[model samples]
Target: IDPRKTETAEIASAHHFIVPGSDAYLLLAMLQLMFERDWVNAGHLAPLLQGVETVRELVAPFTLALAQERTGISAAVIEAMTEKLVQTPRAVFYGRMGVSVQEYGALCQWAIQLINLLAGNVDVVGGALVPNSAAGYVKPGERGAGHFNRFQSRVSGLPEFGGELPATVMAEEMLTPGEGQIRAMLTLAGNPVLSAPSGQQLDQAFEGLDFMVSMDIYINETTRHADYILPPTSALEHDHYDFAFHRLAVRNTARYNEPVFEPEAGALHDWEILNQLSQKLGDHKGIDVKMFPAPSAIVDQSLQQGPYGKHNQRGDDALDLAALREHPHGIDLGPLTPSLPQRLCNEEKNIRLVWQGIADDIERLRIASPPQQQGKLLLIGRRHVRSNNSWMHNSHRLVKGKPRWRCLMNSKDMHEHKLADGDDIVISSRAGEVQTEVEQSDDVMPGVVCLPHGWG
Candidate 1:
């Protein structure tokens, strides 16, 4: 189910248009129904899972009637969707950024995983399974509980997660005056001025930085403020490997791509620039800056030491850098199979279904009411296949045809405002306002509007 009649919804077997930011209520109602009807796979999940009862108790109040009232979806449709999920042999509920940018995003994500686990779909064929990469990159070891809150931001007191602060508070950390205030900033391949929540505030904060460096290919909105801009070699001039994406792929596969063309005379690779900067800072103890003179050597070492490497005892079936280089196309490692329970990397080797952070967020969801819909229209961001943010706007091949940047509004709302298609209108929010062209269509739900992201 989606709020917009997107291309995805057009081809769906069923489409249920839900109210904006009410995903948690709908998911909770489904879980409550599963618990009431005993449709959960209790035997298979009992040994590897925890906090089943806690989730059950927490979702006890989200009945179908209440869910319909909040989500604007009918009770019968919810029941049918729940029935299909329980009866289907393999089903997965994938929630993306739309569910993750709202107030109860954390709770909504937890509920999606809980539904997959309870339905016995985790790690099963055509189900939600953990992706395996041939590169043998094991999950990092767990840390003590105290490690999480060891340091908090000086300005907001927000605790760091995994030794890093959220980017949302970066402007505040720089703007606020204190002993630990950020004065110097280094940005790499990020246009925070357009992507951040408050573009104007970040633009102002960047101006006040004592020293600023941006490592990017283009002098876009954010990089224009940097004191020094370092341009790196283009994609065609770099050897490539899908190091991170392979860990999230549906099937196991490996490929290596040599540079298609040589880089310009003085252009430096991203890693080379970073290595030089590290040397200047006098902290190159364990890096061995000279060991791998080129990036291709690093890829070779990783492939030689990976899970499917020639070092394994699988005889001729094992693969190595030489074999991959010879193939040139790719080496397919076959489809996804069951690798649960043993694949889990927790200290206890079991799923901790009840996280304290998520449990606390559930309380916030329980008492939360949907925002009142009156004259105000809820604005959400969208993207198109032809665009990859502000970076791709310069390519004439992608930006040719017609302009795609406009305020998408519902036909009913456009009629009420006496606005026609392609008319210029002003969109205002607490942060700022922008004047843009409007297009009236019924694709979006009433009382809702859409704007494309990364537009300058």
Candidate 2:
């Protein structure tokens, strides 16, 4: 379910057109039905589940009619979807990037997981089983309490997740001067001016910094303001590892990618440049980059310390960098097996359905007014096939055709606004405005429009 008919929707057997930021409400309504109809089947999970009663109470006020009013979807459709989820054992609820970045993102994500738990679709085959990842975090009886709202940002008082504050608050933190004010800035691997919410605001905030440095290969929008740019080896010149992605899979696999090209003499990789910077910053006399371990050495040591590693010895045969290198196509360790109470992160070894901090937002959702879409169209962001989030568009072969950045508007809205297909218009929000050409299409939901990312 999404605000737009995305490419994924084209292949889906059905698509549910939900309002831009009302996903949490729809999810709560479905959950309400699950409780009222006695459809929740957490058979084996009963002993390990907590807060079932609290979650039921939390969602009680959100009815199908209320959800229909907030979301553009119908009450009957909501009921049918809930029934399907409870009846299908293999069906799981997953929230993606779009929902996770909305105003009610945290609530929507929590609701989705709670729904999956109630449906008994977790940890079983074809369900939501956790992978036996390269890391040892998912072992039985291990505490996996991933950090959340542990601390707040200095200026906005916004909560930090995993030690980093939200990018939305970056400009404000830099622009608002006082104690702990930001005077110098450093950027790595991102062009926030084009990819972040308040692109123009961030661009202005960069102007006031005393010094700024960027670590990137291309001098794009955000990096253009930096006092210095540290160029690194291109993609082909670096060894590759999927440190961020393998943990999300259902099958455990490992692959080490060798660099495609030899590095030019005296050309430093990213880590090498950072090591040199560190030495200079610390004023360490005679410290050399040779003192540090190479990136591959660190990876190799980490692999040996993993569950299948010879040093770890948690499993039978030894698996390490050598084992991975023996098979070029990549070796599948095994399918993810069920790891329940052992995988629970809490001291009690249970999964709590209700988090009071997140549940508190349910009431705010109950009374919140539907978005005002009368004189305005909500803007949604999309990525072009030829470009990633602010990357890969520099290649002429990928950008040789017509301009990929255009405001996609529903044809009905174009008719009411008296706009031709190719008319140039200025799109405005409180943060900033951009003038771009409009393309009429039925793919976008009415009262909503889209713009492609990665374009300056």
Candidate 3:
């Protein structure tokens, strides 16, 4: 956990959070605890934070016991963690990929942000800071809601990057017939079929697409569905500047990688390949300027703007093209300043903790009082940094032999299911079922089960 992103000096003065699988249940408990003990920092709240009163009223019924029952976490532990979170002056709550790929993934992400808001960490230093990369731009682009929010998936209503969501919906779009049925797809450095929900269903959906293209190194699970595959050069062959990673980096640091190999006669770099593709695609219709700006023009302008560029230095930014050329390793920007009074992509120049879309969805889920299923094993996914999926399975160093695949069932649940460790058992959900070997571990909660991803 990076302190720069998690430290806030407002409500609780401390930072804390729970693991992914436990988020939904534990977060509700934290909110309930805050309300129960009057831990909510009412004085620190912004006026636009909606449903605070409604949330207070709603959490009344969800007592500690109820939370423990739903989430399989002990009430005593939840109480302790809640207290720790509120006791410190600058704390942040953080969750990443682990929390964003489940059934309640979005809800969990929203909840983490809510906790940060309730703690008054928004916009403060040592708290989650917004990106300052906007200052480094040339020609000063008008920054506001661009045309990126209008386009959505024809089937599942997923928004595009400009308006469409992640290409995870590529499979669903293929099977669903309507406007924008997705006759073709262009995949870049992604494998959705194995990594996305309902992989089997996604596999079938890809068959429906008229054409599929992939820009990748090796043909993996998703690439098998493509009509044409464009193999790009390996990482070593290209110079690297991680623009996105910089904005998201916890600490202010910069590093650049130089190409190890000299350019061959006809070989193109990734940027060159992308630029050529954009020109062929015509007009940059669905492309974002941030991603595909006219490289030559941008470079020329950047050269004129000086090293740090026009955005960061206002024509005085120390960074200029000559400096960059001299120092190819990159320059560190150093620790960022506290952005407590600054706006982070917000129109009002403040964080929108409880936005309209999120607040409305929470309210709907609150009123539904949906039925909970029994005898269902919660299947959670796990992976190591060394390997992402079956694509890396062939690497002997990463995966020795079929990854240690098994459903981590608590010893108590193991007995309840009349199952033994290493026994073949059928794990089923309402949607479907698969046979997985069982591995009993005391670390798993009584009702919870852990499953390694990419069984196929």
* Local distance difference test values of all predictions, in order: 0.82, 0.83, 0.63
Output the better candidate (2/3) by lDDT: 2
Off by over 4 Å in 1: 139-150, 283-298
Q: Compute each candidate's TM-score over C-alphas.
A: 0.93, 0.94, 0.77
Error of 2 at 239 (Å): 0.9
Q: What would the per-residue lDDT of candidate 1 be over residues 313-425, giving only the tens digit for each residue?
A: 65787776677888788888888777767666666878888878877777788887667777888887888677765667657898888878887899999999999999998
Better candidate by lDDT, 1 or 3 = 1
The window of 10 residues in a row where model 2 has the poorest summed lDDT is 135-144
Across 217-281, the per-residue lDDT of candidate 3 in tens digits comes to 77777888899987777777766656567667766644555678876677665566787777666
Task: Name the 10 consecutive residues with the lowest summed lDDT in model 3.
Answer: 1-10
Better of 1 and 2 by lDDT: 2
| TM-score: the better of candidates 1 and 2 | 2
Q: TM-score of predicted model 1?
A: 0.93
Q: Residues 325-385, candidate 2, lDDT per residue (tens digit)?
A: 7776777889888788776766788887766677678878877877767788888888888
